[model samples]
Target: MPIPACPVVHFELPYRDAARVSTFYQTVFGWQLQPMGPEMGNYILATTSTCDSSAPDALRGSINGGLFPLVPESPLQQPSVVLGVPDVREAMARVSAAGGQVLGEPMAIPGVGDYVVFVDPEGNRLSMLQPLMG
Candidate 1:
C-alpha cells in the first residue's frame, strides 16, 4: 500500500457545553478555541501554543476531537483527541470560513509557538499547533 498524501491523523472528544469546555482548556493550559460547523450544532475545536516543558520548542500535540452536548442516549466525556496541522492560524481561518467558529484567537506559550482550538459542523473537538523557533 502507498502512503496517503494526507491522513485522518487523530480523533477527539465530543462535548455539549462547547463554549464551557473551550474555556476550561484555555484556563487550564492556555489554549485557544475555534468553533466549526453550525450545521453540526456549534461544534468547537481547540489548540495550544505551548509545548511540553521538557521540549520547549517541540510541537507537542495529541489528536483532535469535537465538543457537543452529551445526548441523553450517550452519556460520557468521550476520549480526548489530538490533531496535527502545518499552521495553526491558517487551519483556524480555513475552518471558520467554512462555517466553523473562531472561538478564540491564537495565544502564545512563553517558549512554545502558538495554538488554537476549534470544532467542526459535527461538533468534534480539534486542536492546531505551531512550533516556536529557537
Candidate 2:
C-alpha cells in the first residue's frame, strides 16, 4: 500500500481552569498531565499513550494530546484535532480548494512549527501543523 499523506499527530481539549481540567482528566482517565508555563501559553500536556518504560511501545494508531485554555473569541474555541502536514501553506490552499475556509494566516508556534486552523464546509474546525524538523 502507498504511504499516508498525513496522520493525526496530536489532539487537544479546551478548558477554563487548567488545574481543574488537568485533575479531571488524570482522575477519570488515569492520564498524566504535565504542566506548561505561560511562555507556552499555560498549556497542559496530557499523556494518554506512550512508548516509554512504563508503557509498551504504542501501536501504530494511538497518539498523545494536550489541553489548552479556551479563547472565547477564537474561531476554534471548541475541541479540535491537529493534523500533521508537510507544508502549512500548501495545506491551507488545498483546504480552500476542497471547500474549507482557512480561519487566518499561519502562525509560528515556538518549538512547534507553522500552524493554522480552518473550518470545513460542514462547520467543523480543525488545525494543520507542519512540525519543525530537528
lDDT of 2: 0.85
Q: Put down candidate 1 lDDT per residue, 24-133, tens digits, no spaces.
A: 98899776677866654565655554344466665665434345556668433455444445567777777888887755887664565676666777776555556575
TM-score of each: 0.40, 0.86
In candidate 2, the residue pairs with backbone N, CA or C atoms under 3 Å apart (3 or more residues apart, or in different chains) clash, namely: none
Stretches > 4 Å off in candidate 2: 1-4, 51-60
lDDT of 2 at 35: 85
Query: How far does residue 71 in candidate 2 sit from its true spot (Å)?
Result: 2.4
Error at 47, model 2, angstroms = 1.2
Indicate which candidate wins on lDDT: 2
lDDT of each: 0.60, 0.85
Worst 10 residues of 2 by lDDT: 51-60
Model 1 bad stretches (over 4 Å): 1-79
- Per-residue lDDT tens digits for candidate 2, residues 8-113, read 8888889999889988998998888998889889889888876434546665467788988898997668888899998889889889999999988999988989
lDDT of 1: 0.60
